[model samples]
Target chain A: MAAGKPVVMVTLVSSDGQSFQLLEEAALLSAMVRDTIQIGQGRGPAGIPIRNITGQTLSMVVVYCNKHYTAAAAADGDDAADEEKKVANKKQLREWDEQFINLEQDKLYDILVAANNLGIDGLVDLCCWRFADMMKGKSASEIRVKLGIRDDFTSEQRAQIEKDSPWVWSRTT
Target chain B: MLQPARENEGVWRLSVWCFGVDAGVQFSRCENPIFPLIPSMAQDGGESRDWAEMPSDALSGVFGKLNASDILTGAGLVCRVWRQLATNDPTLWRRVDMSCQADLVENMKAKYAMARIAVNRAAGTMEAFSAEYFVTDDLLLYISTRASSLKSLHLIYCPYISIKGIAEAMKGFTQLEELTLYLSSFHGYVSEAIGRAGQQLICFRLNNAFGYYNCPVDDTEAFWIANNMPELRELQLIGNRLSNDGLIAILDHCLRLESLDVSRCYNVQMDDVLKSKCARIRDLMLPRDQDVFIDSDPSDEGYSYDTDAMYDSEY
Candidate 1:
């Protein structure tokens, strides 16, 4: 986005038939949305249909994009005290990001998929990290409970696996 | 590991689909939770083309970050779908980090057996391996047979990794570029053997790997490094016994050295000429002079606290 150029507002319609307006720069944080908006260049103010993402999910993702885009711009700004400020800004954003993805399990799942669909890299990584945190230091039963996976292993099969790699299984932590 | 009926059923592949280039994909009520659960518009008879149920590529990325033990022991045993995705890949076992094991001496054989699972799974695509805690001659020899494409081998905290095992194993790792050793000392002809073997060696850091190990990295090791490894870039020899002669040998020979860490190399004499030469290096961690800090334990400032609210110092 160039200076003094009039910023176009893009209308994004989520799957549940909800409309949300966004600044072109913030909206363009997603490559998918950016491309969709660009394809309708000069035709008119076209409302791009987000068939994949829900209204609630898309809004959260938009919030994430706006925060990240602003932080990135500030970090890439001028010299002298710039490096110190940039690091501080990055740290602040990281803290904010951690807070942002502190939703419940189901919501986080939705966000992960939504982020993937929108092709937003930062949001995806954040969501992935959040999910990975849940997986960490968890037992096999605990992991299965969280990930909604079924324990289809037979007793005989379990015993064999236990015998084969006892040390790995022994790491309860 | 439960062998999947089909070889590559749920194998996750990274899709490099460019945005806007192919904006043809539409969303539907995906049964798999990892995808968008939009009600299908323009409905088709066939099941959704998300053939793996969820986005397999995303799943791959998640699994890739997990350690060898985590995947093999916990995640792989979770469900049938996960088991297939986790176990049925050779490249996934490229990094076998068994350093996480605490009481290695207790279940040494079992731990090594788990390591062997990864080595066997790797099937020669073992690119980077970092083993620690406990490693024996037999284990090293076993790794040598399997891991041919091994690039980075870090035996950081593995004091038990003997010269014979590592030197003998070096024959297999002809393609090894980044070699890091800390507790495991290279005396005898092992250093010479490493010199002879590692032609493509780039980053060699025998840094005692931030460990409390007082093992000395001497001039004999430096001589071997100088003799071999012409393409070295980043070299860290902490607690090194390299004198003026050995230091000069490195400066004269390895001209492409960009990052040099001789933090504990107190004997390495640095005069004006050598100082000027070292100044040219992009990243340099010169030998810590005594005048900087009058503390006995230089590494710590009593920052970290252990369990039970007690301040723990390495010193």
Candidate 2:
């Protein structure tokens, strides 16, 4: 509620007792966060209890929001120094995003679940696209084992599937 | 037990021996460690095999992410379940581009019809349709009826499409945004029909086919487009008969114009007409042979023609 501070702020509490505070402008990037802020009075400090997200995931989300918020603020300023600094900041943020999403399979799956539950569109898209990219050049069986999927086919059904797509079985790599 | 010893006893003994040989005999019994583990290994192998097949929904999700070529060659024909899942995903058929194969128009039509049916059943609507060749007027009408949600239509090398067909098709598509027509033989009538359709067209591309048979500079289609389509942002006229007047009209009308390509247009002097008329034009494509001259003489008509000067300055 201070004069220089953001008009709205959201307090996100992860399952591990860690809290992430974000400015309204940054939170508005997510429709869910914007709607939540709209429902509550924009004046008071509010805490959003996120049951699904963990400390690690919540930290990553906050980092993304903070970077975007600073970039947006710098873009709004008319000063040449601010504009030049913001362009350099944006390039650095892009590199950070590329590195931030390079997580292991198990961590990636957890992040995907957290992002989906938190209604983070950008994060969800990044995770899904990464998963889809991993699926390339992999056979059906390899994909099943890698993704931890159970085979629900009968012996007759398995034979039929193999008969329908012999390429899936005959692929070398 | 001892029996009476006689010549008949020997014969009876031999008969008993023959009977014993005919019956099954038993050897020494022993245990092998490797044989005991075979059953368990086979059972483990079966368990791993069972873990290979994935759930149907997950398979569908993976298939939905594949591109069109992969969907056709790999996912659609994988299995009954995969085929069902791949066919069910609507995003797979959002944009159907058959512009690359003009020679196999009939085959492409058949494939498109089948794709339309599948997409309709799965997604409930087909949003866009693009084709290289327009063989019959009826085909265009049919496409218009089937793809009701169609927004973008690209036609290339298809001269058979008349103004009437375009008018009929444009009537249904109120949300049409981008239209790219290449080698179209339609003239002023088609441009008029497009203007009447009342849809906000953003991009219009017309190639050599829109020009006159010999003297392309005589074609007035460019003027018609400049006067009518006010929402035009990008315009490309290749091998057309666009003059300085037509270029001026376009520059005056399309205020939001970003990119313009007017290659092989002999009539319009680039530096004299374009640069003076539209100052905001960023991306411009001009023919290589023509030299832009900048004429400063007030008495002569070429004085206003600063084509050569502007060309030299830019280079």
Candidate 3:
């Protein structure tokens, strides 16, 4: 509550009754959360309930926030030891992120929804990027199967979709 | 004994039937509950190997960064996931720079039309239009219908375009901030058309298009300027038949004028126009060889003018 304190803590409660407490500066990376906190004016610490996120997803969100907070703190301190420590910490966080994002389709969906609900822009972007990378060399039909998207088209419509973009099939195989 | 055995068997069969029905209902309910579970149950079903699912909004953000060609050939033809994303990404269709591919103008037009549809669907409005090559009046009219919310337009070496097409397009673009037209064969009619568009044009560049020879040596240009563009900040006119009087008329009218380029306009005297009229002109590109002749005697109509200076400033 002190002026120029440089850090404010916020409590986020998930749908499955999991609590996530994070430093406000780290959470401010998400524009939506930052704006909400500014509007709330220190009332967020009482607990801002995120109704759409599950417990597993909320845990992942907290891990991301904690890592970012520690890295930012180390970088802020003016010393060679702090600088070296920050670099090592950043590398470790990057590895953790790479491993953490390797989730199953259902879990990934849950994380994406949770990230959106929590207003975590970095997590959402990372998940989206990962999805795009998976889609890079896949054919249209293969993509449909992978995503488990129902074939909404009738037989005639299916033929038309393929005929309209024949290069999609020819290029893949 | 027989009755007791038959009752016991019937009860066992009834329990099995009820259990089967319950299991079927549960499987149906859990088939695709917000997320698919089959990928996790497959051969490579671990969190470390399975493909991560993305939200639609996030997918749209990624698609917005792809270029026009990539969007058309690669992203557009991809599965429903990518096709939907690419179709809804407005930034992909913002500035269609079709100047470099002069030979593929026809192909580019078809591509532009497709891109416009995608852009309109995504952004609800197309804001910017740029064409480097010669665009016909028909094409311009076609563009105007879709791109009603256009803010900036750049056209260079487009000879087929007349004043009428530009005027029609300008009527819809009430929010137009910048307009650049170079090496066009338009005359006073086009200038008058621009005046009637009712846009507070900030930057206007009309070079090698409107001259005295292109129009009658009357007060057509002056009248057009006075009526139309009062808020014009930058004006570039090259090889135009703007005399000292005409230049002064423009200066008096456009009060907010900051930059003026009247290079190769030989009819106007440099000292009279530059010093008196365009004092606010910062970046002026005029005939370099022309010198200021401040004569002691004013009434010297028969004084021989230097032809060398005229020949030197050939631009």
Candidate 4:
């Protein structure tokens, strides 16, 4: 839609004093960004400072938002009028999201936290789905090990949980 | 269109990166930027940023993706915070669905216990409930006492729950809006109780076993629904033996009904007069409609809703 119009650019400053610039539409993927821009709070001489998010994490978030926004724009393009083409576009985007989210646990955690702080609903859902997948079909101990969770429950606590719902401990399979 | 850097932008330089497939996607310069200063969930656990201590909002997101079994066993057992959320969070237990757990069916006693645990977790604020195979009279009574705020109840293939149990249970569910009973047999008293109590009911689905030999040409269930449920917007009597007379009764009483599904109910003739009578319904599914039972069962694998002895017809 903005093919001929001048692109509005927004500058974002990461926690470690790193500044990145992106198209305004793409930056609006983050609700925080949309709210800030709507309130005219981020029209400073320097870019809006993103506290807590490191330069590395902020850059990844920017890449994700830009990729998704571009894909969304393409889907909304006139050529994507056909239902089949729209489905194909969605499939391709899903594939790309899968690849993009294939990060190490620490990186995944950072992205999840960053997504939540920025009020990025889609990114938060993606991250949560990934975590759910990791926990699926695995026992509590297995999940604790996989997700680096400590076994803090006492023997009594564990027994009480098991007692409350024995079906949960036993494999339905 | 590279604009000259303003005086305040002396230290910052914009670099254009070519993002995959889409070339020359610029990530630079907007008039307004977002300054997100909110502390992350990780910060709640102090500097270590422990995964176990992640806040409830993010944890609930993950919980939303998990099934009943996963929540009860896996996440609830993970850590203290996770356990707290799993056991105490009324929002999580508000709409408990314990159906479609094929593996859990083998141990009926344990499954029943698990269902009770889930209900208890709701802490009497449950709004919607769905379950199959393992429900009993005691359990239904338990739910009735606790979940008076329940709005939707879907029970599938619950052989152990008696007709008296359902009747007694309906007394507590005065605010119920949607109810689905699949393969669960119930007669006059249960229907009367539901009709009396479920004044706010908008949708009622009573699906029996399918097949030609299964027909008994009964209309008692249909008449009860027609006389009692005036607010019904959707009614599905799939594989019922109710004839044209019953259908007419339902049409006469349930004036507000927009959808009616009598698929596989061979007893109903659907004559031109009856057809014209039902023309007002936006979605009318006739007996010959193919695959009407597609959305019949819950998303569980092992337990299919098809049971040969589901309806006696003799009654």
For candidate 3 chain B, the 10 contiguous residues with the lowest summed lDDT are B43-52
Query: Ranking under lDDT, best-scoring first?
Result: 4, 1, 3, 2
B-chain TM-score, candidate 3:
0.64
lDDT tens digits, residue span B1-315, model 4: 122223322211211111221111111122112312312212211122357877578888888788766787788788888898887777778888888877755778876776787778888888998998889989998998889999999999888887788888998897899999888665543466574765678999877656342345778878888888999999988777789999999999998999999887877887898989998999989987855445443234533334345554424
- Report model 4's interface C-alpha RMSD after superposition on the true interface residues: 10.9
Q: Pick the candidate with the highest TM-score.
A: 4
Q: List where candidate 3 sits over 4 angstroms from the true fold.
A: A1-22, A31-117, A120-173, B1-45, B48-53, B67-70, B85-106, B115-124, B171-175, B182-189, B207-223, B238-244, B261-273, B281-315
lDDT of 2 by residue, B1-315 (tens): 011123332433453354453211110011112233222221101111221234444444455565443454344544455556665777667776656653465455444454444445435366666677744466666666666676777887776777777878777666677777787766444566776443377877777542221233443666677777788888887756668788888788788889888765767766755677666888877643322342233244543344556335633
DockQ value of candidate 2: 0.04
DockQ scores for all the models shown? 0.13, 0.04, 0.12, 0.24
How well does candidate 3 match the true structure, expressed as C-alpha RMSD?
14.8
Q: Docking category for candidate 3?
A: incorrect
Candidate 3 lDDT for residue B293 = 43
Model 4, A1-173: lDDT tens digits are 45697888898887767788888889899999999999987756686889988776788799888899998888777474598888888899899889888764555777888899899999999988887876777778767655556778877886887677666555411
- In candidate 2, stretches whose alpha carbon ends up further than 4 angstroms from where it belongs are A1-49, A53-85, A135-173, B1-142, B155-174, B182-200, B208-216, B223-231, B243-259, B270-284, B289-315
Q: Candidate 1, residues B1-315: lDDT per residue as tens digits?
A: 011122221221111031222212222234333344433321221223331245665566666767887777676666666667776777679887777567657866767787788888888889888877667778878888888798888875676776777778888887888888865454454456674565788988876422221333357767777778788999987756677678777877888889888875666657987888787689988776322433355335452224222112211
- Name the candidate that leads on DockQ: 4
